[model samples]
Target: MKHSEFDEEFDVIVIGVGAAGAAAALSAHERGASVLVVEKCPPKCAGGNTRVSGSGWFINSSPERAAVFLRALNGSRTVAEDVVQTWASETAKNSDWLADLGATARPTGAYHTEAEFSEVDGADCYAGMNTINGEMGQFLLYEFLVGALAERGIEIRFETRAQELTVVDGTVRGVRVEGPTGEATLGARGGVVLATGGFAANPEMVQDYLPLDEYVLWGSPHSTGDGHRMAQRVGADMWHMGNMMTITGIDVGDTTGLFLALWAGHDYMFIAPDGRRFTDETKGNRHGHVQRNGAEELFPLRPFHIVFDEKLRAAGPLSPTSAVLPVGWKLLMENFVWSTDNSVEVANGQIRRADTLRELAAAIGVDPDTLERSVHDYNAACDVGRDDHFGRDPETLAPVSEGPFYSLRVVPLLGWSDGGPRRDGHSRVLDTRGEVIEGLYAAGEASATYSWTKDGGFHIADALAFGRVSGAHAASRVAS
Candidate 1:
């Protein structure tokens, strides 16, 4: 069981090879450390989540435009100002690094449209991506990054499943990986980095860790939280246990339930536990259909409906083949994206189209009078380019003119959200007692207390950023 003698110890050992792990490994290797990147799946499998998301500098970021975004993200939360500064400073280098590794970063403006940008520095600029399937933006992203690392003389052992960590004297020394040939002891001379992703892939863990239905994660099966479990087993501090995410995608049907085509957006609604409409789809500071049931905030709608007009449907939201998911494609296609068609109404849980507004509300099972009044208020505003109630999309309104209007029930989909285990600006994983867990580092979805989930954009970007920082930091510890 002890392979400290025959074990192939390296200066640094990185687990997982996605965006975070890849960045970490590259940074460590560039620093003159001999590295071993262990991946359970081959190149294709490791592509995981980053392989499919939209193209853009998420969290509404840019070197010139970050301060406001960061402050807005921090809000009342206990975020390290210095860490925000570091993430802003290093993003460009990371961008360039990614470009060098064959990943092309295109620019998508921070605002959805140029109309929303403020004329100020230290502000967030919108930049989007154009990643692809064979484009190395696809499954090949892992392949390209890994190849770049190997060319640098870093040892990459593929098909290696790292099952356990070997700790000595309270610090992690290395890991025990089981490969196809046989089990091998891979020791880390300095430290071990767990860039292994989230528990979205594991239904069991989904039940144990999250409060929502286990169907929230629309990511990879390989991201079954092996790293989370292993880290927790060794007493690694879990900062944002409540911060795990549950994404709501279009529930296609019985067989193909939750079809996640990023290019084909999910125009679904966020309904309350009781069937009722809440927030206007086009309104809100953050932009994910699934998030939380705010305990303190007093809002009329708990779960928001993401309805679209007949005009939206005709736009022909992009398909699964495109690089970007058109934001509302899925809901549009499923008639779940608000419509006035009988066919779509029939398909959406037997929603009925009313010859009159009262009849329509009754068919959908919502408050008939309240629903009619809401419709009247919404239509009056739609005629002009303004939403009086919630200040929704001023320009993108189309009256529910065509009849037998349909509405699908919506509900808040929650991911987990934990509130403790603070870290410094460096993103070091801390212990239960609020001290750094020396030689051990955590990133990606694994460390969430510092995440700027005030909106959906920062959650991912931070995950990617910290993933890199933790990896490089772990590698640095290996040399001394």
Candidate 2:
């Protein structure tokens, strides 16, 4: 908590190990620079939300389709033309970088614009998943890259906190770190790359940025805005403060699966607190849906409901990549912390698997007549090839008509911090004036204002590309 003075030197000092951190460390080290990774949390959980995400980063977005996505989501303000063009060109370069490393990145042939696991391509852009080896937001990669760095004798200090940046003159200097015994100053002789994650999970940060009263987090405990706070203390210019996360259907009051089931086959028809349908879910892509100002509609951020029968129940919950029967009962039970069976029960709040239509509707809190009418309309449409209400994926509409219906709650979760310090093509952090902050280089999520179409949907290739850029440029400035 207190700060004195000490100094440690390296070619680069990386603060986090999520996807960008992994790529940054590996790329920085590969170019023959001494690097040190400083982590403030458990090694297994160091990757943050990157571990739980779908892991595919968007690269080489088909321009026509990517443009469509940008327009549809009203995100023309979030990403600029030069940014997109620059990122698109570097797509394959990052792919090459990943392959040369010990990691595997297979083109998934699908572009994801939604939280759901499936991929879709439209006039807006090429969106889909890129398969990675680990679940920690490219967790397998952190394992590979971090281990590789250790092998090269790149020292990493765990349980180490970087509380201050040692800046001298207008140019950058090193940082002050606090460890178990005493404080030490770790200097980045060449450059200091701050990939220290974001503050999405921090209450004050979330409230300051997101403006949410009831909060549920999907990211790691370490993402308490260490990056934003540290940068802010030094008069760093911050932008896009009005933006909050574009989440799926997350139950603000519940905890389980860390809010991932928003699209995980829990398909529940969402209604506002007043209970009415909003949005045509099947009509547009997922990114488009998440970006919608649901508050402008009736629900003011409605929650989702999945009406199913014994058939779908037996069929099970779904995973996008895997073909196993999907974890049905497991999805149900695992929702509640105290449930002995781990199956979601009515007593556990919104999860309902009932024997009759009216009973299920009553338990779910919608007017029985409305639910029945909606179901009848849905079933009729299902028979005649229409969704009339929300236009859900036809393949998913199996008719909640079967006796003993079920409902599971789902919501959009803030997967990771998508907003950070703006950076140039070379990963240099820029102030609000668009001038480069000398000696302050950022990459990965820390410097993440870039060629993106929607929320949390950046291509993994971009992370690698920028990581390489930041490191390559940093290596040049360091003494040989």
Candidate 3:
């Protein structure tokens, strides 16, 4: 713990250049603290989950109402009352805080305005506060934060990965980092903040903690539990390790996954491995959870195929066609645009097509009769103008009868995991015994306060709120 050999030093050291880390760095700098940010990914892949997110930031107009809604959303899984209170109160200041930073807000339609749990008590308190000129699944917010950091001359070490926290007698002293040049120890005079995000891209963590056997990742590839491991190594308590934000998407290879635009129209259906229609595919899927058997639960974990006809294929792009931002990681990172007609996917074998329904079933490795029966039932429901089984909207009951039928394989898309080092309301990392680890802090998805379900903009909201808290505290702390 007494590593006197330090290569560099800063008043505050922030890990991961995402929303939380950027906020922490900026807040620290505002307090006249010399801050350095370490990012695991290169400049091109840097920003963490914030860069790839839908860019929907929010502020709570009423903290009391937000508290009620957050409690309802959390249900049985709850944190300390003080922590929840701070979460609501601080989140309420997000709009004002962003405004102070010279960021302007704009409406982003229903997806950003509406609360994920509309039926919850404080749903009315949810107010969308997207950045001006921002769109769903864009880097405008991240860019804004980065630009602010540059304006302040904050030093950021890209491709530098934090390996471990150097603890000197129960207090974090510095960080041992491995960078492109090699490994070195960097001393933090005030504290270190871990905003390294969640472990969505880590397969082992996913298998051990999450219930999904296989799924496409819709989050940053750099989110491999770096902060989780470092925090745990320093005796940090982990909470909500099993909770996640899940959705459904199609894997188009090369790390490209597309979220189907179910809201676009209903000329297609999701057929499970059993060649049967399971849940209402058109229902508003709340982070992949649905009200089933009187409790919210995840959608069935199984491989699925989007069965559609030539009409839907020719309608337009299968994914969102009008998103100002790229909807998927590969598209955003690699600049791989999805074909307008979806013909490129079919030619690339990402989508299976056949002239006959039986041929389509065979191509997708499902029993022909079962697939045909499932499609027949769906078409019959369309004919009768009602979906008795899944209760899909009667207005979206367009039959998928025109040949040649197409099937695109898809799996659950994990947005992010909200589990890592437990942090107090002030965003200080807490030990296993609920004691603060001095000179150590955490924010964002890695140390999210939400125990169970999270709302639309809660992740970014938490990051900004707690990031500022940690930054201000770290900057004001007495340097040893």
Model 1, span 1-480: residue lDDT tens:
334453687877888776667667787777777778888887545544554334233434465466555555445654667666766656545456566666665444422333122332333454433232213223444456667777787766778988988887888788889988899877776677777766665667656655555243334556677887777777766644444443434343321123222222223222333333455543332333222353212122233333333433343431232233322222212223333222453455533334675665565556666666666666777778686655556655556555545454333332323232345556665666767666666655545434434433344455556766766777677555
Off by over 4 Å in 2: 1-5, 57-75, 78-86, 108-138, 211-215, 240-268, 281-302, 318-350, 356-358, 387-398, 450-459
TM-score of each: 0.73, 0.77, 0.94
lDDT of 3 by residue, 89-157 (tens): 988887677778887766676456777787888899987646545456668888888988898899889
The whole-model lDDT of each prediction reads 0.53, 0.56, 0.83
User: What is the C-alpha lDDT profile of model 2 across 1-480, one tens digit per residue?
Assistant: 122333557877777766666666777787887788787766655665455444566644565555444433334355555555555555545545666765676544444443341233343344444555422232444566667666677766778888877777765567777777678887776677777776666778766665455545554556777877777665576654434443444453543233333243423344433334555443333431332444211112334565656555554332222221111111222323322232544455546767776787777777777777666776676677667666666776545566667766555454445566677766766776777777677766565553233433452455666777777777767745
Clashing pairs in 3: 54-137
Mark the 10 consecutive residues where model 3 has the least summed lDDT: 319-328
Best by TM-score: 3
Q: What lDDT score goes with residue 184 in model 2?
A: 85
